[model samples]
Target: MECVGVRFAHSPKIYDYRFGSQAPPVGSWVVVKTPRGLELAKVRTEPRLGQAVGEIVRVATPADLDQHSKLKNRAEEVYWWLKARLRREGVRAKLLGCEFTLDGNHISVQYSAEQRIDLRRWVSELNRLAGARVEFVALGPRDQTAYLGTLGACGMESCCSNWLQDFTQVSIKMARDQQLPLSPEKISGPCGRLLCCLQYEHQQYQELLAELPRKNSKACSLQGVCGKVAKLNPLAGTVDLVTEEGSTVTVHKSELRWE
Candidate 1:
């Protein structure tokens, strides 16, 4: 009933495999039979009884790792080769990354494009060169971010690469709720979509926003203005108010009362 959580090579997503007859240690590299093919994946967490997406094939030996590396070494070559062919064949797509199974029986590609591409010829050429089944998977904004990981604007490894297993729909409202810069470069991650991290404190922001009075609502302030609440800072517990004389003043939340 136990299962092993496994991640394949720098991917943030993890899949569970039936422990079956093997109990690999955390961080151990093990061969697993994923739906894609035989892949060598790392044991990502402590084993537990859980549903599994696939089953462990065996503990990956040094030989297995060496072969896996050899196949991976061909990634750049395969990438360039496909890029050239796609161009020659007038296939319009941006190739993001390529993955090879541990057994070198299959190669999966991630790409993006504005329109659907006819890939039968492309796949055949790849299958002939790599001697494996070729899979071309379309990637979304989040998938593009994961395939080619990058440092985020926060100056750290992006969350998607480090630990994000799945992406949630991000909205402009989340950015507005957090008072983030509305600029595209500032609000969007390396993925060119709203940063996935924005949702981390979204619920809290929504709760806090609800607790505070809205703009232009009448509120009592220590400044003795009593005109209207202009802005609210939930984290700082401060509010900005406009006075009857049209002067704006800031006051702590403790000094304000809303009807």
Candidate 2:
């Protein structure tokens, strides 16, 4: 079946929809019947490879865009309304935002919390105010950051919010392999997990590290000075060696020997 990539907002997620008859051009707005409801989404790409469980209703027109904008604005209002209501009810949760269906028939709210929140009343109140079905989507701290978005420690946009479609497991081993500061504050990102960028050059680091001796292992320089492998700089292709007298010297890995 022919597939298309449709996305409702600036979110990184794109949904695949089967459009057997309505193959619209990329960047065109189209109404799609998602499991949530009728969603007004933009055609990001054609021939998208995925399970197309949903079907395209029709190509959205100017009036549809106007209506979508108005409903989106109302959805934003509902987000704040829910926030205030939660605060008044003393519910512990952080509201990320709301995604409203194209026809304003349903709304899915993304939020984060430490524990389960009784949002049945909140959902009812929102449905009453919105005149639409309201859903609360529970998210992890990382997924919350991905949806709400924030600048990363690298002075750039968060990867997950921008281009990272899926998250990979990150661990302290990646940090140690990269020889970065082991401090949580230094290694952790806004998601309170290891920075996603740590995995960027990790494979290269692993390959380079394999070619060099491990730290604290026995190694000697070309000058016959041998002690322990103090530090390894893969980028510079040099290894810092500590002599028997506790003196240290930096030498290229090619000139070092473990024998």
Candidate 3:
């Protein structure tokens, strides 16, 4: 026999099902048994590398699909109710989204807030109406992108939703690398997290930096001795040269007309 579990994305939940002889193929949606009830979820990855401890079970039924769809809609409705209720309560926060397990056993609400919130009472009330085990998870900006994502400045789907598995910390130094302006509003996303793409190319820029001379190296030019590489201003393509003789001059990196 084999034991398999349905992996739920965007939430830390899983539905373990018994597979007697065979296992559901990867990425396939299956109905699994849980403490609360049966639920539907896609198999993200194949169950461990080996065969089952028991026999494989049957795939999901048509009725299971129908119930899954209904549960999803109901979860969305519950999310809206929470959103409206929170707004009425004067809590200004973002409702990232909600996820309902296929078994109808569990639901998770993802939210982004400025600070801590006491949603215990509200969550209990929701469970009474939802008639299921409810889990409220507080999501940060990066987690928000993982749950409820949108397009980025590059006009494509968010990296967090599509490819980024882990969220790496982002800082202002990254903005300075590609010559981006130091404006936080321009560099940050709606989630207020650093752009995911920053981590992608930082190494390339760092590698390219090795070939370039330091900004403080003195330049011995025919016109005079310059104190340091004042700037590699791309727009000007010039390094502002400060002279040992108390003079400042600009020289192009390509055209060292200084000679």
Q: Which 10-residue window in model 1 sums to the lowest lDDT? A: 221-230
In model 2, state the lDDT of residue 42. 84
Model 2: ten consecutive residues of lowest lDDT:
118-127
Q: Write the per-residue lDDT of candidate 3 for residues 60-137, one digit (tens) a residue.
A: 778877887898899888989988998899987788777677766688787778898777778678888787788888
Over the stretch 167-198, how does candidate 2's per-residue lDDT look in tens digits? 89888998998888899999998989889899
List the global CA lDDT of all models: 0.84, 0.84, 0.68
TM-score of 2: 0.92
Q: Tens digit of lDDT per residue, candidate 1, span 126-221?
A: 888888889888987777778778999899989998889888888999988887779999998887888989999999988888877787798886
Please give the lDDT score for candidate 2.
0.84
Q: Give the winner by lDDT: 1 or 2.
A: 2
> Would you list the clashing residue pairs of candidate 2?
none
TM-score of each: 0.92, 0.92, 0.72
Off by over 4 Å in 1: none
